[model samples]
Target: MDERRESPGQADGAGRHREGEALPAPPRPPRGEELGGGGFAAEGQYFLKYDHSSYQQFRSWAPAVLFWAAVLCSIRFPAAAAAERSGEESAPPRVRVVIAPTLSYGPLWIALEEGFFRDEGLDVELLTMRRTAEALPSLAAGEVEVLGSHILPSHMNVIARGGRVRIVADKGHHDPDGCTSEAIVAAPSVIASGRLDDPARFEGLRVATDKGMSGYFYIDTLLATLGVSAEVLRTFDLPLSSKEAGFTNGAIDFSTAAEPWLTRLVRSGTAVKWKAVEDFVPGFQSGVILYGPALLDEDQGTGTRFLAGYLRGIRRYNEGKTDRNVEIIAEATELDPELVREACWISMRDDGEIDVESLVGYQRWALREGLIDRAVAPEEFWDPSFVRGANEILRSREAR
Candidate 1:
């Protein structure tokens, strides 16, 4: 092996200098200048050298060292920041993760307030986006680091468009009933017509959807099963937040949405639950953790650290022994604590671990829904190494 020594005053990103350079001799003070030297060194000695040749040599090596130093600093910043940020503290790697504001997003809440994210070295800042679709695009565009949102369709569409994103982990899957995120609802007109008692009555009623959203696919699947065709139910593009009011105000006869909007419509009596998507598609997961591909590809170390922290969070979240976890979720999601508790019962898994079965199911749904032109393999969208590493970390802790 070639033996190379690092020069004195030469530092890496961690601020560690080499012992290769020569030390300067001690100097005598002029008179009584208050002795600036510290306790470690004698009164007149200087820690740094000020020599012409030495300075020139440093300049020669400085550019390359500085370049690599920056690279290392970028990689090390998050870990260092994570170390400094305690549960109640803030740090550089403390990412501001945004999730849709709803009861379904309770697990993220549990992770944050329970100190799971902090344990993972993340200073999580959870924000509730009224519309996840609208929010996810920003994450893809590098406006944010992580987002908790529906994994299918939008995630696929993003990948198709060449956005650097991957579904590293999953939150919850469709219940045993096969319902995923959206619940099918009929407008007051359809519900009040008493025709709701008759399945054929919905044939000609207009239904509003986000057009390309999972809700749209849920409605399509429901209609196809019932022998209803697209022509029978007029499909209109509508925003989810606006859908409830539209259905109640007689603008549309049917619509699909996620809770608490779905719950709100049912509670307010503006609409009735027609069907849950999980009724047909079982083990369908929702709310995935995504990061830009560039980060993973270019900065492998930082990317690894990020995933390690993420998995650490997952490990902490899996220890759900009581309602304390539920309360954490409630506060994070800003939903009523009672509603969160109820939602938490059906929601599975708090960690960002991927459910293989659910991912395949979702990919199948996207394929069937024509969201993607061709059948893209599930692995194309998922990177399992991170999840596996997280599992290993947890297993190691258990072993210890």
Candidate 2:
């Protein structure tokens, strides 16, 4: 019953505080510890009880977290960094090209065989179709990136309709020096009759052609150039494969033929080369390398690289139809090597130069023949920038 005990809640002067005004609760200890004191000696020093259970739990999971973090960093960072450093972490870009299964695509085959495309960071796949018309839809749809064939009347028709296909590079041309694949052939009966000796005798003769194709136009132009009225001759559309049979049966009197068919015809004594197309249409562009809109407009670099590699192959091809090249051509075309060696090789410009005037003239003729409804300007169909840029690159490499 002392005065200090009279009010139990009041301060007793023994480091005790009034009940309602309890000393501000000791500052809460930091995480993982509890606060305690050991009397007056330990007054200022907090006795923190270590949270060993919690520490043990954190320790148990730390290695796993660190391990996962390291794994994620490696997965995210090193591959990208290594790819940047090596410059070859990814495979080369692939270009899907379509071509007719004809010797006209010699440069493309040469490019594939000689690794020209590989040198340009491209993986080119050459798909062979029986005809260009079969590939045109794919070209328009971007399913096919390139087409190796002639600029046909049908192509002009497509251009007139605002189609997105374009002629980017020249594949083959009619050389004035008699280096040409196309020729006018007459059946042996016609040759034996000596009618081929006179150009006028070609009048009123039936000619076979792959209608809607450049060959049809070639025969038309050839006759006109030779002073024979194209109207006088009757044209029958026939596939090149069937021309041999037609000639054998005397159904084809006259036809524009390309090697190795021309060679095969002569060797088998079924027909004879009456005249080379180059004789009249000198420097005529018979075949071209076409590009779809996706390649020409959206992905121009690939188009440029393809042309560069194609030009390299063309330059190599122009090295004078060697035996090795004949073998290569034979292997690609599946024709006999002897026939390939004997057949006339189409002339392609070393620089992939296209005869723009010839192309325009062909289009004009197509318009006149009602093949195309309107004329499409050369600029609309020909984009020479890729070819020009490719040539510049080739020249720089040669200079280097």
Candidate 3:
């Protein structure tokens, strides 16, 4: 039989360290030889003999000591270790958004300015585009995650063609109270012609609007409501940037206007507000918050957080047309504060629920007019999960 020898640092069967293996370091002797009676001296100070056994013992246990040190560090600062493993701490993911510089985007502006997005662990960047048409390509390409604009026939047509886009939330709408941002404005010449109030006289008049835009549908609806055949009215295609000039030069008889343009037109004596669009179509959805595939499919969590922040901002906006909001709107639009204060505020739903009936009605009208190839079902066009989740989160916080 072979005999095994115990290691030097191993404890005995009685749980005692091996002989001379666990000796405590000798206490320091007094500084003087009379006090310590040391045999060696260095630089006029007596010195004790060097201990090789202690050095050997320290070397034997060094690995375990270092290992325990690391374990203790991890226990104390686990988050720091996890962060280092994942790389430098990162800021919240950014959600790029495109919006028109209109008062209808008040909620978006409020959300951005109030740091609501940040609070929800999202960074929002707002890109200003003059028209929704101008932003559609970017939205489709995933360059932008969200867009605030009127729900146009073009949007429906895109969906009908399998475009990965959908309306997620309400932006603005016309209300029964007749408080609307959009109005039908007539030029000074048309107003002076005494035909502004006469619906019958509206026939054959030149109405300017961007083709395939919500304004086009609005004009047709207005003409139909006035008992005038839309076929008889001359539809002039004009960009919004040029509409003011067109009205001033008397190049257009009528056009859809929104503040602060409406206020500017009336104040400039170039045009007069003939009627608010709400007077004809109450509870019409004039604008919506659209989401693209990137947000809905790839990063839905960020989208959900974004909606939570947006709903919070909407609540703040619905606090009524206060002076602070007017100032905020003025600063955002770069318009005069007084003009912003006097401009009509766009109506929005406080609960973030969209008017599904209004959206369906508009879609049917567009289909009938051949503006879209086919009607998109509500499920295919509207996604309520984000809003529902956001509301749940908000409600829980309120309860807390």
Q: Scored by CA lDDT, what does every candidate get?
A: 0.56, 0.71, 0.71
Q: What is residue 327's positional error in candidate 2, in angstroms?
A: 2.3
**Residue 170 displacement (Å), model 1:** 0.9
Q: Which candidate, 1 or 2, would have the higher TM-score against the true structure? A: 2
Using Cα atoms with residue i matched to residue i, what is each candidate's TM-score against the true structure? 0.66, 0.75, 0.76
Instruction: Find the candidate with the highest TM-score and give its number.
Output: 3
Candidate structures ordered by lDDT, highest first:
3, 2, 1
Q: Write the per-residue lDDT of candidate 1 for residues 1-400, one digit (tens) a residue.
A: 1111111112331112222224332222221112211111111121123345534544554565555555555655676667677544433353435555565555555545445555655444554444455555656765556666676577777776777787777656667643234567887666667875666776767778765666666676677777776667777887555776787678888777676666666777888887776776556665577766434465444444555555554545555425676665555545676654443233455345566676666567668767775544667777777666666666777799
lDDT of 3 by residue, 35-66 (tens): 22112211122223225643454456546556
Greater TM-score among 1 and 3 belongs to: 3
Positional deviation of residue 6's Cα in model 3 after best superposition, in angstroms: 78
- What does the lDDT read for residue 285 in candidate 3? 83
Best-to-worst TM-score order: 3, 2, 1
After aligning candidate 2 to the native by TM-score, how far in Å is the CA of 369 from where it should be? 0.8
